[model samples]
Target: MPNSTTDTYLIGDMKNGKPFNGFFIYPRTNIWLIFDFYLNGKRLFQVYNDLLTASMVEDTETSFTAISNKNIFVNDRLKSGIEVTPVRVKKGIVDIARNVNNFRTTGFILTLFDNRSPEYIEIRPIAHGYELISTDKNTIEVTYHASGKKLVFRDLEGRVLTKSKRFNSDHYSITLEKLAYTLKYRLVDAESLERFVKEQW
Candidate 1:
């Protein structure tokens, strides 16, 4: 692939001689904005969020800061964005394009500079409707929203662990045993979710 220079998130600058900008999408937040800038194959300037600015000398650094600006868009809605200062950064190098089974297991944990506790966290296998389960013998609690809402805090074997109150929202979560493997069970938003699953399966 030659790479794309023409996108909605990029801004052309003939004056500054910057040809293209790279954009990244935050899957959980549904936020899409400029992720990096390439000026003739050299990454001169890069921004993680809308607030902070960074420079790439040799392209080793993976983390960047997010700044509040009018250019940033979240969920296809415009807003006065806030700054995202990374509290922790992880570095990984792999060819995801070639190996279609690559799924990002861990993600960046970010805490705002002004806030003490972490505000934003990223996780994998996100979709409109999904269920997290422990692949081991441990029981996983869940509230399945089929035709009627049912709350069963139990494992797949129907061992009742706890009871949950009635909820009406499609967005929900249940914890999986940390030591055991987990599986997401659901097929919501088939067009986007199915394609991702097929590639990563």
Candidate 2:
């Protein structure tokens, strides 16, 4: 069972407890978990992977962003099947893209958490040429540029959840992950993520 190479496993008439495999990307780390009936059991697998991924990384962009924002979210899917939820959305500033002094890294972070929970998400740009797009619960998309920026949160039905405030300089950007928190929150910002990339000549 340890060295097995089967892509799929079946349980309870292919319906009950078959092993499931998935990956969770956090702001600080990227972790993978595999559930199998045999090797070390399911509980051990979850515990091991969670602990492994929770290890701190040097360049933690997501954790920094989350802290800057002051809110967090967990995957809605994990709420049903998995028992553990590692900081799905950090409450801080996510660097969407940067073109500062010729260096560029373009990406976005998806946040999650309840809006009425007395906490909000934040996005801050460490470098100058960064942009943030906030897609609130209402599914309305608003783009935030460096200067002459406004903050707005809308519901999916085109109703304004909240109005946008002008922002010239803020520390972070934020959003609430409704159902897709699991799909989006898996992007972690770490120093070692660069190592996984192949070098070019």
| lDDT string, candidate 2, 41-89, tens digits | 2211211132212223343644333321101112222211122222422
Write down the TM-score for model 2: 0.23
Q: What is the lDDT of every predicted structure here?
A: 0.30, 0.27
* TM-score, per-candidate, Cα-based: 0.25, 0.23
Off by over 4 Å in 1: 1-11, 14-30, 44-46, 50-161, 168-201
* Candidate 1 residue pairs in clash (backbone atoms < 3 Å): 49-65, 49-66, 49-67, 50-67, 51-66, 51-67, 51-68
Residue runs of model 2 more than 4 Å from their true location after superposition: 1-4, 7-85, 88-142, 160-201
RMSD (Å) of each candidate, 1 decimal = 15.1, 16.5
| Prediction 2 global C-alpha lDDT | 0.27
In candidate 1, position 124 carries an lDDT of 27
In model 2, which range of ten residues has the least summed lDDT? 192-201
